[model samples]
Target: MFTYDTTRATAEAFAVAAPIDAPVSRGRRRIRELCADCVRIVLADLLLVLYRLRTVGLENIPTEGGALVIHNHVSVVDWLFVFVACPRVPRFVMHYRDYDRPGFRWLFDAFGVIPIAPKKEDPELLARADRAIDEALAAGDLVVICPEGTMTPDGELSPFREGATRIARRCNVPVVPVVLVGLWGSIFSRKNGSPLSSLPRAGRAQVSIVAGPPVAPGRVSTAYLVEMVTLLRGRHR
Candidate 1:
């Protein structure tokens, strides 16, 4: 394992401040390191310091109640914006590899990461993920899923994965479609299976986050979901 963090990489690492999902009254005691709210506030500040970005349609995120947010994956730190834009408290089930990493342990617990295996459809991993989704839904929390399996090296949306569909159907929740553009164009964009290097300076990267109304669970075919998201994502491209 490397002894330090890679510079100009798109990987994510941060702590949360407040609990957008659950709040504790003044008369009650709080759990250890439960600082999601603080994390959000800090993250907002950190993002501004790290890169220049433009977010649109964030208001579409429901101001209240549970929501399942689906977005195209680009930069690894893109999740920071998801938390910032979301109105309600948020939690996301992430790629299992992220949670399994040693240094990423803080990110998993600090930001409430849910383990999800994509490259390998391990039954055990699926079972754990299913349980986590159920608990999140039961807690009336917003669910953030990439549904694209993994981050795209070429800075484009990947084919939508089916696991998110299965979870949304099982939980009977509405799916919010979102389009993320420009996070990867920054120094954060990772190497495409080659020596790590930053793209030529583009005078700060441009990014857009568009949150559309939620799509309720249905019997729609996978092709339909793919087309719907692709078209919506194209709106800003």
Candidate 2:
């Protein structure tokens, strides 16, 4: 087991960083209260039926705050591990393009996922998303993001877009880097010319999630973020 205390730490990895101070929510919530709770229950049941999530270092996740969680984008269900690691309720910054898919749309809307236009050239969309992030942080909620922008075509890692640092700086919130490993080899792992229907009849996965220390804003850098991401990725190797 690995232990981490990241709720308090100075930022040093980047040339531009700031202190994020999103407060923790004072109210109470249950995962069932989100948009489509019955579906979330179904997802939980599916996790048991199809995937055996071997989660570790959950304690590394900060329990409370306006924290920005940057994670690797692998499978479509990355949020599942986060829901298990983060507090009962966590918000995701998802892509607008995914909102229309029936199966995924149900889940996304049910969880109150905030959507961002997939087109990076859309300044208005970006601005809207930035404000939504600020509002969510100000309300003391956890925001889960995949800095790589989209799901990887292959399981290999991709470049993390620069938006994470911006969100951290804009909200002055600590960025927690999370790595989801082993899922690519699990039931939902992608295959050549195979669609979702081709997934195994039943499968088990060795899923793991490790959170790095919460990094302060203002002093964050691209290298530091990569280093943190690399550290999280190391757990699976």
Candidate 3:
């Protein structure tokens, strides 16, 4: 059987990087959850076969309760790694442009994804999307958002927006900061100005998903999150 180790050293480093002490809620899920246990296992195995996949601090993901997950965006496939590693199937807050793309709606719909567009594009649409996110959080669902808004054109982390902070504050939920390592030169990343411009790595490329303990809603901020993700990523591009 193929397996991976989540060493205590890694967990400790992540904890010290972002000190956190928040209550975990274990409540019955009120909304439909996607990615059943079996599906997650299968996807994880597939990822393992495709890359040198390593994860740390998954336990930081609350077993039950509404929480906001913030992560640095590197590639188009960043969500796949987060989905398989999280303890629960999280409702992804994705860009409407990507979520509404043809051939992807089926998958996004299955997970009850909340799609948001620029307020200038359609104020009503944005309002509805916000309402949907609120309802999902109230139902004790985990929601993941990339505050950078889009995948990075360069390997460096982009300036984070206030969306995550707003959600965590309004919903009164913990904010879990996550970082992805070693996805910079991937085919899906904008490594050379545009995605697919660069060739993919041969064999299994080393990748890591480091998830830190949840930050209290009161402590969540754009600058704080940027610092936490930067500390966790630590020299990895």
Candidate 4:
């Protein structure tokens, strides 16, 4: 929905305002120190029971260090699948509206999710998100972003946004591109109609997550990320 210029311009402005060397807040720093294994285990098990999840190339996720994770936006539960598949608990950049959801407010806060508004709508929120992402990476934490900006209206990939690439380039971190398969028809997805409007499919859905090796910051771009994700999705298609 956002034009390339708007997204890139906001990101560029944020990069200028918030240098990569900026310090992280004490509260944020302390939260990142705590292990989220318990939460991760609980959510991963729940998803496993509900959907037949298959993962490949998880080894590509670095055991330690700051890295940028870029993935396709498919379903509302896509982040859950990503959390389950990754070795570390990643701090995600989520929409501010989702963060304001009544029931999930605590979850997002506890997990240190960064809330962002679209650049065109609220450049201030986007600036804060960019700073948060830069600080998190500077603190040597894993950060995940869905460059498609929102879930797909159709079951096909959307053009990538420059925000993710901008963050990676500014922080000089590796970007890992991942693709999720077989979630398009699920109740959580915008498939067949409005999400949650139709009854959930009868049986457990089969899902797969494929990850490609990390792309260096210098080499990573929106176009390259789109190409990699398209190829990965093609494997399952």
Candidate 5:
């Protein structure tokens, strides 16, 4: 193991050899992120056409600063719609099993998806996910979480877990509530109790994404979020 002096000396040597200009690095990173966003939007356009998607109150998603975006989980493609709708590229907090899937791991890693499991499954994994979320929020990054923990089996909304409220309070960030309408009977939903076995709708599904104003951290709660989302969802499934 290296001592403090040795580590400092090594760092100094590297810095001297290749001094990094902070402003230039930041500018380059911003440009790269913008380019990536452009690519994401282009890909999302295809889905938009396929789904005949519409969005409402999208301005509620902050362009800057950290916040928790909590939404109901009704289908497998819910995250994709949220990902495409947000102005800022948000980091998704997804299930560890999904993140660790054999073929899709590369895609999740490329987008920096945060994989989380229950403490009962693995305490260390849960701890790491919590830390990653905190760090991301501290860095003013948007973090999206599906508080239902899993997709609803039926077309109705499921009771939300307390994780979203807890994170919002701890990080002192607002909670942005979003609702996905018209995904309940889609192929991605658990309509037949299995997404894989379900078939796509006959025509392009008219999907709507409704976003509400950010709720203050002090007022955040599992019930309140569920209510807000339900109201936004209206009579739609």
Candidate 6:
């Protein structure tokens, strides 16, 4: 089952801050950004209607400024859920393979998702991703990353990778932990077999998304994130 955080610290940590720095010049660049926001608004509305999504701790998310939004990966559409719940349109860090997929390449391109690969496979690409993340954060853009790196084979939360922590430390940004529950057994999840092979289960699935307090860059770690996410997921029998 999923759980919510109601502590005073969590509440105080997310007190709204002033808007992020908007240094973009007027003209094509500004117009493009506005168009993207419009698309996200439409998509978020559609998702809420289709899945009946429920979100908690939205106030825990800072309204503006740079943040490393971290979440446990469960379904292929997990990012979509997080995007809908967030106050800002975050640039997601995606696996290069997923970003290169023919069918979805356009979407990734349009959203400016950062594509990253394993260091061993492509050190250059990894370096580029790091630089991109740093630049985005400096520009006051929230960046979303799935710490698990890949989807979970089962419903259990996997150990988070170090990338999220490293990025937060490098960029000096708060690491916000968000968890998506009730996604297992869905068509986008690897419940019965390969994901997407089976038809969607009947009825609108009830999904609970909880956002935890932002962990400071110095205090964030893989183990800490794992524990926080596990607590958020709670005991599912």
Alpha-carbon RMSD to native, per candidate: 7.9, 9.8, 9.4, 9.9, 10.5, 8.7
What are the models' TM-scores?
0.77, 0.75, 0.83, 0.85, 0.84, 0.85
Q: Provide the lDDT at 78 for model 4.
A: 90
Off by over 4 Å in 4: 1-35
Model 3: how far residue 173 lies from native, Å: 0.4
> Order of all candidates by TM-score, from best down to worst?
4, 6, 5, 3, 1, 2
In candidate 5, the residue pairs with backbone N, CA or C atoms under 3 Å apart (3 or more residues apart, or in different chains) clash, namely none
Task: Compute the lDDT for candidate 5.
Answer: 0.76
lDDT, candidate 4, at 32: 36
1-237 per-residue lDDT for model 3 (tens digits): 323332211222211110011122232121123123434566778988889987788889897999989898999889989988887778888888898799867656555678788788978768877888887788788899999998998888898988899999999999999999988888989886688877778889988888988999999888999998988888444
What lDDT score is found at residue 201 in candidate 2? 46
Clashes of each: 13, 11, 0, 0, 0, 0
Candidate 5 per-residue C-alpha lDDT over 144-230 given as tens digits, one digit per residue, 9 for 90 to 100: 999889889888778888889899999999999999998888878898868868667788988888889999999988888888888
Residue 132 displacement in candidate 5 (angstroms): 0.6
What residue pairs clash in candidate 3, if any at all? Answer: none
Task: Between candidates 1 and 6, name the one with more favorable TM-score.
Answer: 6
lDDT of 1 by residue, 1-237 (tens): 001122322222233322323342322112212355445556767666555656666777766566678888776677877776676557788776676788766755555567777445677777767776777776566888888877777866678878768777888777778877766655555544422355545454556677776677784345666776788778877
lDDT order of candidates, top first: 4, 3, 5, 6, 2, 1
Q: Give the runs in model 2 whose Cα sits over 4 Å from its true position.
A: 1-42, 103-107, 118-121, 191-197, 201-203
- Superior by lDDT: candidate 1 or candidate 2: 2
lDDT of 4: 0.78
Q: Give the per-residue lDDT of model 6 (tens digit) for 1-237.
A: 112222211222222221112233334234434445555566766776668677788788888888988888899889888876777667889999988898766556545578899999999889888888887888788889999887999888776789998888888999888888889999999998888999887888888888988898899888998887788778322
* Candidate 4: worst-modelled 10 consecutive residues by lDDT: 1-10
Stretches of candidate 6 off by over 4 Å are 1-29, 235-237
- Summing lDDT over every window of 10 consecutive residues in candidate 3, give the lowest-scoring window: 14-23
